[model samples]
Target: MVRIVPFAVEQWMDEYETWAKYNIAETCSASISIDDLRSLSDDPSRDPLSTSTKLTYGAIRGSQTLRSHIARLYAPPTGDDSSTTVSAENVLITPGAIQANFLLLYTLIQPGDHVVCHYPTYQQLYSVPESLGADVSLWKTSGEDGWKLDLEELKAMVRPSTKMIIVNNPQNPTGAFISQEVLAGIIDIARQSSIYVLCDEVYRPLFHSLDKTEWPPSLLSLGYDRSIVTGSMSKVFSLAGIRLGWIASLHRSIIEDCAAARDYTTISVSQVDDRIATFALDPLHAGKLLDRNLQLAKRNLGILKGFIDAHRDTCDWVVPRAGTTAFIRFSRDGRPVDDVALCQMLQDSKGVMLVPGRRCFGEEFKGYVRIGYVAETEVLETGLRELGEFLKAEYASVPLI
Candidate 1:
């Protein structure tokens, strides 16, 4: 039996998310209905569903339309207007980015393989590899420095046996973005050692805080053949209902290997989901959907910023430059508070859901809580207001660590 570490963040969400009244812990950018999706498109008459078409396991690798759209995301700034270097052949659709990550890891990682993974990221990124019997080293980053991974440290961590280096761009929990310079440096290091670089880009293109010029290109576009990226419609597109994601890479062998492993796990994603993803990612509609989410993220982040600012004495954070989540530390009289207890109390008494960082991310992240602030404006507002009240009424009761 493979002994895998319990997925703390997922377990926490499964336990608390369904019942919470103010679900501010949600990481998606306010999920939208099919009706909401149609409203954004130029033509509401074109339905996402094809009722007459036969749905016999649809396309095994995913629909060509969906795959094409996924490929377009990796196009370079100065590339040909008509086509991207990454073709539909380079993309493989999966149930979600989670599944994509799993498939890739299962295909590439083996016993005794060495992996260097970014810290303060989704547990699955590192934990899954560890479960697969790989020797994993955490390339730790500090919140004090805005969750930036030091390239020199990453260089030092790379060994001749290092199989892969993994990262979460616009990382979860902290919502800190890895800049273009850093990405290039990472690629440079990987190239020298022939190490595969896997970047989980699930929260991409939702850079609410940074200007367009500061935006980093996808790992696929960084001129590295071994670079691989996984992304989904769930986060920036506001289409979690479809459960559609894809793995895109410049490396043909990587895609082929993942596809082989995926046969046992998933024959094909739902036909209905494929169609919906295609429609949502259509050039006519993709921009509009992203625009709505970007606006929502910015607006909600401001509101969250206000909440953090108002409680400066008790709260501290490196303001997120992108993505939906923010990692905030709560301190009492200059000491860390018990974040697990704090999250539980907030959920039980105040009905506001929050993810405890120490419990979910790692033990080193004491007193931290991840707030997914890009929820519906009203929900975020209410949750933050109640949280403020909770602090005033019950914070003293929460033990100092």
Candidate 2:
């Protein structure tokens, strides 16, 4: 077995305490509460006094109620069956979306398989597959192009041995989304190549502009039997503490394969966590939480954009249409700056920590940094001000290369 080193995402967690003053620790959503989790539990009449004390390995394949709720989140409305119609048998609730992605990679990819993923996405998408001994190739998202995927390049990258295509819509850091047309095109390519599409859709439904008539259709809703979706309450619903996520696939074989693989890995999600997740998924509670998050994201994004406008000469962004984060590029006289050095300088001097883009990509994206604007609006605004001050001081002292 190839030994995988620690994840870069985990490495950044250490800097959080040092930079707490700037409040850029906006990577994950705010923690959830009992109020957010009560909907998933059993009826008071059925289980009376809640026996969470009896925690001897709960359901191995998640509770039917929780799994059923997760399934409804993924299934689209059909002729005879509404979007809500999904079987609990088709769901395998895992520890989190991270584990869900890991299980999918373990189940579908072999050591020598080839997998394609978008660059500067949630690092786990590529890292997990690489750790599994698959040859990983990146489909780079251009900053100039609003970080959209180029299907033409994607077509050129696909090979006969390609086993899976990983995607993160409402993408991390960049917040770029795959349009329905682009998704359709990618699906066609995957179908021709006989590859499965794995979508990390944790950030779904966080659209900045709710007035848009059409939302990007989920890959699963496109009717691709080979497509699998992994989602969680971590981001969209701001229930990261629940640690509840699941995988949904139209193909029974894939679902069974993941279930078998899961047995060796997580075995099952915690019963308490699963119950809380189910409660959060309740339409009333889930909708309210998502609405609140969207409002926060939009307000924070505006604050970030205002800062960018103030520092147009030092930094700029593609400006995400949706999602919680944005990728910002810094340069002097059109020459790229050292993002890692800049990130470290900001951390040490101003106590602002931003994720260096190089950490998001294997080798590319050296001059960019991924910053989240999902915190309180005032917090994001303050961080941006500190970032601006740091950049101004840094560039003022050094000559453009």
Candidate 3:
């Protein structure tokens, strides 16, 4: 039996994703039409992919070609760090990053083991460990610190029993990333304690265009033998429909173990889906998609910043440096706003949808909401207006608590 609680964010998305007219809640990559995908088929290089057989379960450890592509994505372009080119043997394909986490936690954690995880992250990073009976310590991120995870606090929390540390970079909801220096420090901490780091780096490639000159750090490179990075085509590729993802590690044992655990559920990703994902990762196509997402995040973020500026007193946000979403607080007289009520009222009155912070960040930050402002430009404009109207009409700043 699955002991984990039902995912509240998914529940909200289920009911409203289709129903909402102005959905600013989605953090999708550049939307594509079916024809747009079909257009990729026109490429002479991808012609052979169409005939890929589907009768077989596909390669057990992911197709060598697909894994090779994934491996290359993490390798440094040149110079001193070039040695980190992950091999196919180190990659394990999963249905999605969510499932990748499941396989890793199920493989590594035992009852009574300690796990330290960054909070306000994708819930499975912490909750799944708890459900597995690991004593979970949350390294909570605060708005006052720009939602950055504090290393000193994490240093205080680790114990001899700690087995794993789950981290999400360009993190969910808050959208803050750890610097290379910070990542190196974490790697040091993990090495000293003999802890494995499971980094959910789904948003790594989605760094905002504002910071294009610099690159996001990779835990696989930073943590040496003890790190595992998992990601899906979902976030940065806008390929949620494909149900494709992978886990990359330097240790072949972790990949082997996750593959063994994968036997219980999702033995292999779709043969056809794997082929398409492989096609999507082709150097040119992949580069094109990267450029598209960078443009979208840069444009939409500016729009979001303007909206935040307009309501500066009523709301505030630490502008995101990467990823499609940011954590925003709606306040009433300088206190946390009732985000649940606000989201409900907006849905009812304006048909708007925003994730309540409690759903992603946990109970301590209920006044905040996760807004994925990377919607179609017109849709986002109206969503912001709707949210503004509702904020003004009801909670116009008379402190309650």
Which candidate ranks first by TM-score, i.e. highest? 1
Better of 1 and 2 by lDDT: 1
lDDT of 2 at 15: 51
What lDDT tens digits, residue by residue, belong to model 2 across residues 1-401?
A: 66676677667766554546775756665545674345334454433125655876778888887787777676664563533334777777888888889888888988899999987787788888898899999888788777878899989999999999998887887878888899889999999978899988888868775455567867777877898888887888777776888888878789899888787778678877876676677654566677778888777777777888988888888888777777887787787677777777777888887877776454567678788778766667778788777776765543322
Give the per-residue lDDT of model 1 (tens digit) for 1-401.
Answer: 77899999999999999999999998999999988877876675798878899979989999898999988878777743532399999999999998999889989999899999999899999999999999999999998887989999998998988999999998998999999899999999999989999999999978889999888878777778989999999999988878889898888888998999899989999999999999988989898888889999999988988989899989999999999999999999999999999999999998999999999999999999999999999999999999999999999999978
Question: What TM-score does model 1 achieve against the real structure?
Answer: 0.98
Off by over 4 Å in 2: 15-19, 35-53, 77-85, 392-401
Give one clash count per candidate, in the order shown: 0, 2, 0
Cα lDDT tens digits for candidate 3, 1-401? 65888777878788777888788888676566535655655465544246646469888777888888888788775675645667878889888788888889988999999999988788778878888899999888888888877889989999999999888887887878877778888888899988999899888778775454566568887637989999888888778787888888998888888888888887778887788778777676777777778887888888888989998888888888877788998777667777777777778888998888865567887678888866677888888888878778866542333
lDDT of each: 0.92, 0.77, 0.80
The RMSD of every model to the true structure, in order and in angstroms, is: 1.4, 3.2, 2.2
- Evaluate model 1: give its lDDT: 0.92
TM-score of 3: 0.94
Model 3 ranges with Cα > 4 A deviation: 38-54, 394-401
The C-alpha local distance difference test score for the whole of candidate 3 amounts to: 0.80
Tell me the lDDT of model 1 at 386: 98
The alpha-carbon lDDT assigned to residue 238 of candidate 2 equals 76
